[model samples]
Target: MFMNWRRIRKWHFLRLISMCCVVSLLMVCWEHVDHHVVSHMKSYSYRYMINSFSFVNKSLSVSQEEAARFNSFPYLLNQNNVCKDKDVLLLLFVKSSPENFERRQAIRSTWGNESYVSHELGVILKVVFVMGVHTDVTNSFLLQDLHEEHKNYGDLVQQEFLDTFHNLTIKLLLQFRWMHENCAHARFMMSADDDVFVHMPNLVRYLQDLRRRNVRDHWVGHVHRGAPPIRSKNSKYFMPFDMYQWNSYPDYTAGAGYVISGDVAAKIYQATLSLNASMYIDDVFMGICAIAAGVSPQEHVYFSGEGRTPYHPCIYEKMITSHGHENDIRYLWKAATAPEVQGISSGLVGKLYCTAVKMMLLCKPYFSNTYSCMAAFT
Candidate 1:
């Protein structure tokens, strides 16, 4: 009886200690939990309860006079003849920084090679590099090199604004406005960062199939849905309360690479004319513009979401674009486009083998941004 009483007392003492520890932990984590977890819960609830995103349209729209300032920058290097009077299938806009000459050149020799697309893929794809003048005064000498590049390739489209992180919205404006003025009739327009590796052969075939079906209002990429905004000031992608008080942003695609039909491109341009472009993050700004324009982003399994894909033949067989491939783009382009890759998933034995391999590579407890677990079964 004495021992039983002592054991009960010990159990109560341990329970009391555990309760205190849990309470202390909750107190310490309350602020972070409230901002990230509670805010997202509230925002997602509000998102579904609303009828339409018309409120976002009202909040982001500005007067035409105010909007004109965003698009009024003069072009320093213009390429009016890049797509003039041509049956262009795809107009690819590579958003390159002023200093990434090697990346641009690597792309041109690899996936951005227009001659290869025309001869091998049988599609007239126009590739153009869009950038702004260097912001740093000490790097002024590079302008001579830029001028030489423009003279040689005639594919550089630059504006007068400084190329900085905050000016990315301005660059986005440059792409849409340039397309509006020059290549509005192209069947599809793609915007991609210079580091992204695009499988041109696969992409050309996909676009050709869409064209044959005359698909309209199509915009496809790696889609982010119901994502909460980062309120932490230290974060590079921080969103202040004054700028965007909403807890969640509308669905958007990763700006690393995405494709929009010509009609959707025109819609986005018209939306840009009235919407305020103060959101410096180009991909979020794109989501805002798309919301205002009533175009929804579609998710493609093969498009990467801000992460590099595992180097594998099964992955290359269906990949449209993979992000964060600067150093090995040449090697990936060579390996991914090899003639043998096309037959890796053809027969019964091949399909089962590739599916198992993809499962091993893609299905993980942690997030793998290349493709989802469902991709393995598919």
Candidate 2:
């Protein structure tokens, strides 16, 4: 009887200790937990309310005088003749840093080869690299090299601004401004990073279909909906209250790569003129501009977010853009555009095999940032 009483006492003591520890842990982590979970919920609710009432445009509006300074930088290097005599189908603007010469070359030799695209796809796709001058004084020598490169390729579009992370919105302005002035008649325009891998054939086919259907106001990519702003100072994308007090950013596509029809591109350009460009995060600024123009982004499963897609024939068969391909672009271009990739989805057996392969690759408890699991069935 004595031992039974002691056992019960010990069990109660342990339970009390466990409960105390759990409570202490919760107390210690409450701030962090609240910041992430509760803050996000509040942000989502607020975003939904504002979006439903169509108040985003008014909330993000800026004075016209302030907006005039956004795209006022003069062009140091310009190409006014890229789409001169061609019925251009796609005007692709590659956002490259001044020092990414190697990446530009790799693209030229691989999927961005204009000659290959014209011969194979029988469509006029113009690829132009947009950039700002290097800020570092030591890298001043690169200016001559850049000029020579532009002279050689005639595809570089540069402006007189420092190439810094905060100036991404400036670069964004450059693309649309150039398109508005020069390539206004192109059917579609694509903005992409130098490191992104674009499967030219698949993209051409998709755009061709859209053109046939006369799709307007079309902007498609990997969409981020209800994304909360990063408040931590350590984050590169941190948004301060003074900059953007909003809890959630308007729905925007990832800046790594995205496509817009010619009409939509024009609308975005006009929106930039009126909306504030001080929101230096280019993609978020794009969302604000899109909201002002009454345009919404369309999500495509094949468009990757910040992460690269898994390497497989099944993925290659449908991929539009894969981010973070700084090194293996050549090899990936060869493998992804191989003739056999077409055969992998031809007949019933091949289709089943690819579908099963995609399911295994994409269906995971954790998100892959690439294609969603539903892409396997499609």
Candidate 3:
């Protein structure tokens, strides 16, 4: 035993340290493999691109800087500075033309008749996208406040008429945040673009069910492990950052997406107050705000960007909402209320053929102005 101890003591301390180092490295690699599995979504490259932009120099003018900083990417905004009631789920839209909204109303009156606006369902307080609005949209934003005899709106009505609107992504959040702070009776808030075709009736059902389960978490159209941010001017919305400095962000539901629960929205809004803007669009902004808020984003699996698909086979599934392109808002109504499919098999996923062409012909006369969809679209 004494001879064996002598041999063991003879080993070099440096050799022992090297062995320990190798073991530590292997353990780290193993732990990482076990804990941080990579996912197969196509967005990983975009994530990498965004991180690269962080290395760029930040050298824009103060005014231009503010414009550039807030302008960011993906969604545009009007310069209007305003406040909204907290109790309402504000649906903000940015259009090159506000006049188009009038025509949109015509489209709604003509075909919106088929929309599902149930009392217990999701609700929207649609507003102009800030970018498209005049530089002073904020003055108009105070319409509900100027007539203070009836109401007194706060934060949203900031002191700026020339101020460009916050990004739709940010504006929606701003609206919700302003309201939560202002409205006491308000229980929840959601922000979505005008283009998104939301299934309000189903959303209401989901919310009611969620409430029963006592769940209060923020949900967005969720993407699991988004790759690094990609920086490209051609893409409408781009991200520029390393896999965010943090290991992960609460999966972000895109800004065209919505937020739920007044408290979480409020918390996120507060989280964003001091958060410096990021290079990527909504998702990055959301990542920063979520991180600042310390509120982990919960992925609501039902959210989709598939548009009319919202009304298809998943029609019976639980859905908070989904995304649709700016041009296809009316298409959703047409797809959902197609009288022919009331009880038939789910036909929304089928190929668009001559019938679709015929539908367009029927819809052309009235919709030609600003309307889209076949005559039978709604």
Query: Per-residue error at 352 for model 1, in Å?
Result: 1.0
Candidate closest to the true structure, highest lDDT: 2
lDDT of 2: 0.90
Task: State the lDDT of candidate 3 residue by residue for 143-222, as single tens digits.
Answer: 43333411321111222222233344444444544454444234455555555555555555566666567666655454
Candidate 1 per-residue lDDT, tens place, 104-145, comes to 999999999999998988889999999988877467679888
Q: What is every candidate's alpha-carbon RMSD to the true fold? A: 3.5, 3.7, 16.5
Worst 10 residues of 1 by lDDT: 44-53
Extract clashing residue pairs from model 1.
none
Candidate 2 C-alpha error for residue 252, in Å: 0.6
Off by over 4 Å in 3: 1-99, 102-132, 135-173, 238-250, 278-280, 306-320, 325-331, 334-378
Candidate 3 yields a Cα-based lDDT of 0.43
Question: What ranking of all candidate models by lDDT puts the best one first?
Answer: 2, 1, 3
Candidate 2, after superposition: displacement of residue 187 in Å?
0.5
